[model samples]
Target: MSRIPTAELSRYLLAGQLTRNGCLYSQIPRIPPARQLRRPSTGQTRTLNTQSDPTTTPTTPQNAPTPAITPLRKQLKDQAKAAKASGKKKKKKNVDNQTVPGWDLTVGIEIHAQLNTARKLFSPAASSVNDKPNSHVALFDVAMPGSQPLFQPETLIPAVRAALALGCNIQPVSRFDRKHYFHWDQPSGYQITQYYHPFARDGCISLQARDGIAAEDGEGVEIGIQQVQMEQDTAKTMAQPGGVHWLDFNRVGLPLVEIITRPQIHHPATAVALVRKVQMLLRSVDACVLGMEAGGLRADINVSVRRTGAEGLGTRTEIKNLSSFKAVEDAIIAERDRQIAVLEAGGVVAGETRGWSLGSTETRRLRGKEGEVDYRYMPDPDLAPVVIGEDLVARLASSLGMLPDAEVDQLIDEYGLSAKDAISLTTIDNGSRIEYFYRVLDALEQQLGIKADIESTDDAKQRRALIAANWCLHELGKLVETAPGVETAALSGDAETLVPSAALATILAHLHSRRITTKVAKELFWRAFRREISADTVTTAIDDDGLWFKELSQDEYAALADEVVQGEEKVLGEFARFKQGKAKAYPQGKLMFLVGKMMRQGGDQRMDPAEAERVLRARIEEVHLSGLGE
Candidate 1:
């Protein structure tokens, strides 16, 4: 089959030889003919073939030739059939048996993100939550008749910073275009967005798979980013009883970084993971709070499942307003299943947009593909191009602080911590707590004049590192977890009265040096933190109370130890019995109960579990006891 070039097809359409009915013609008249042409020699004779000869055939005039189109018509029909067949084959291949039949699903996503800034993008309106709706709206945001659209410099910096952090390329010049759409929530019929040149483009994000642990296999898959643009949020929609809706303009004009991802994501699980990773990165840079419950961020998921070797994507339907990560995941799976079922039932899934109903956990189509409304997009003449200079980028980079990913990597490499531990520690949001924890480590090393060789640490250094890590993870983490949602700065201020870094260092140093037992160290740590006493003061108090060296009196200690030995006799007998051939039923609960009683009787002083176990084992061996009857 032969194909006509696009240029020739366009020319045919322009010349009116082809009509919308799909017809082709050799010649078309320019205008209505006024009269027929007549031969000069014969005034009333009809034009016919002339110059007939014995050996030569008569010639037909060019303009007066017969209009025989059977050959041309056959050629056109053959070409059309070939094109149609080719198209059908391509479609069939796209819908081949590679996929599970019966389902027809499509997806689209709209992300509503809270811009990382202190103020609204267009107005001097304080970007705070407590501000009144109308009060927060600047003159421009309220669409004051003569007011010009103004861009907030502060807002742009964070937006750009977030874009760069996401590995996006910042366009040198990006303009805000007006997307005209109507809603009561949108006081202005148009929204300012970068439909043409967005702030960031061609980026990627790596998402962890559903595995409980980080896979040993290199990093996770990279989801290709489509574009990240700055846009103003519409007003909050409040649904009231009786089918009425309320609009709160306070949310309007709030800067948002709308990050769109390509539909390249295949698996529903991967989609969930990608959203999580994106949320993590946004939080790491302090770009978004990512409070799914608070409506701080939302995702619009686009999903389309096609058969293997498909020439193009299947009909894509967008699931909008997936506020929670769980919802995003559930919606994708649901849509995929729905699509497969439709296909299997010999029904076509229409390309359209849908909204996820959290209550029903089903997607309802809002509009079909052809029904999509044109959001007339044009450059906003009132606003100029956003110019991003190198200085601004540098400033933003510096202000964004250390991202969590980089911090996690540092913790793993520098502290030799496990990936899980690093993720946990780096996820700590209390900035002051993080700073204080580091400060304590610094003071400990300074006071002891100990240089930690993390790579080749001897026994002493390893012990110190372990102590530091344990204290941070167990003791400090417990405190932070129990504390209310207050910044670490407040806690640090209270540190002077509570356990200061100096005091913590002193106690940890003692623990690291093995001068105090684990029980003693824990007690001292609690006391120091509770009383907010200095190390010297805590040490002196312990000494003055004879709590530090009271155990040095072997006779008294031995007596207390003997009491524990007698009390845990049953446990000791069980240990011996387990060693023998006869194995009787032993309850770990009962053993722990006896251990607790012994520790309590000794005032938790003479013998901790470790010491008690050691003593019990030795005494049990010495006695050579037989098995206790069940």
Candidate 2:
């Protein structure tokens, strides 16, 4: 018996075999390397290719091919290396300086939005939108004894739907945790939320960069989403002149969806756009009303400034209770500048939470890092884990309407609307106005057998669609904006009630088909909307036989226009001279004055000014030709 050498044993192990080292063997067996190995053939011994020949292929008895690494495995290894390199590059690119550094901006947002539901999350009390302060309160709202928190299925659906629309993944199981903090408004001394296992995670929103700021091409920067959790809203606190804070418990125990974003936003404008996008998305899914002024939605912005290539994030400061997009932008800029100034003047930019003073356009310090209070987060003992099923997700997916960004894109592509017009049409002012406008459009389109053109078209269709969009954005917007003493709900409801679907469709259809001028459609719109007249009635009334034209005969109107030209003889002469290649300065001032007088004499009906101008030029030409003949 002979023992195998350690080197031979190592080689055997590399060839996928187990062999004992320094052990005597009664019978010696030989195995080849995998690359030169072959299946055994009956009554044949195969020889391995150990020669240094590059071209001569290895020949084995069974002709079995050697196993090689798969392409996918190779590709995976390459991708891992690339990712590692990218991460290293990012780490090495950090630039840090004591004086003002490089001013790298990072932002994160936390939104507290009230859910639009019929009942409170933990109580059976009504959650009506119009309920008076403290009127919809349950015993639990006041921390009543033995009051157990009960989950609201109805409220959770909207939040889940909203998160799904934002591209978030819903977790199978979510647990409610109690966040404890003492405040006069928080009677229970804690807020129940899903801190550990949130309902949804990793949602994203897209926003455009403002002028002078550079954004990435095609796809914008991806801001990592932390979580969107369901929580109970705190009661309202009203401060009186005598330093007394009165508590209203009506809103207590209401369901709220708190959406938190990662600190990836770099610019102030991007932060503002992200907030706006989130607000619109929440409203689109009917999760929360997008009310910034009345506090239906509130945002706390965390912003920090560092050197452009810094190693780590700078000291972050939270701007609390920003109710509007403008205020959020102002606060970020103000805070960034303040921090930069501090660093430039040899002062440390301390990590703190501050409140944005809208009146002063500044952020005042509230609490420093040393003074920061902990919420004492713990799992809620009373409530069990909320298990969401496929049925609920499917139902929500079906009902979750188009996101605001998608709607804007559709309007631009389908209706040939301008960016500004599309934005205006999709924006919800306190949520009610946008809903009402859409309801009106929807009903009108259905009633008039017209479909919404959400696709792009050629020149003719583009022009018509632009006209329709302009009318909707301008005339309709004015009606909604100026409706006196009207609550947003009333205004929205009234718009739906008063603006007949059939008439609106008729107007849009006529504009789409280019059958009516924009001016004529506007006049008809006022008549139909304010006077409750039908589209046909307004069209007929303004047509040849209608009262609008019947009030002034064509012959008399022509005579009055002729008289206007005669009164503006100097301007007419100049216009005629310019047309004849004399290139005289036309008397625009006098011609407009004469036209104004003629309009007054003709009962002040809205007329197309360009058409009137054409008529005046034609009449002036006729008079000049007659004079030449004479």
Q: Which has the greatest lDDT? A: 2
lDDT values for all models: 0.64, 0.67
Candidate 2: which stretches are off by over 4 Å?
1-101, 209-219, 369-373, 429-464, 479-494, 506-521, 543-630
User: Relative to the unseen true structure, what is the C-alpha lDDT of residue 410 in candidate 2, on a scale of 0 to 100?
Assistant: 75
Clashing pairs counted in every model:
25, 7
TM-scores for every predicted model = 0.66, 0.67
Highest TM-score against the true fold, candidate: 2
What is candidate 2's lDDT per residue for 1-630, written digit by digit as tens? 665455554344333234554333324443333343333545433222232332344565676665554576677677668878777442221112112335677789998888878888888888764565566888777676566888878888778877886788899899999888766567778889888899899987656532112243224656667899999988777653322344567888888888899898877766767777777777777777646766888999988887777789988888888999778877877788788888879899888889886534358998864331477788999999999998889888988767777777876787677677677666644444445545545544554454566532466545555655565557776655666543454445334554554676666665454455565666677667676578566556656533232234556656778877655566666666666667656657656776677766665444444556555556666764355421
lDDT of 1 by residue, 1-630 (tens): 356655454333222124333234324423211123254555643211121121343344878755554565677677668878787543222113223443333333456679768788788777766554344667666565566777888888768877877888887788899888765566667888888878779887655432221232225666677889999888776664323344456777889999888765655555656666666677667788645656888898878877765567787777778898768766777677777778768899887777776534357887754331478788889888988887777777778777766776766666666667666555444223345557777777766776555444555444455567667667765655665653454344233334577888888766655456676776777777666456778677667656652332434444554566575666665665666646565445554665565567766554446555445444445453533332
- Per-prediction CA RMSD (Å): 22.5, 27.4
Candidate 1 has a TM-score of 0.66
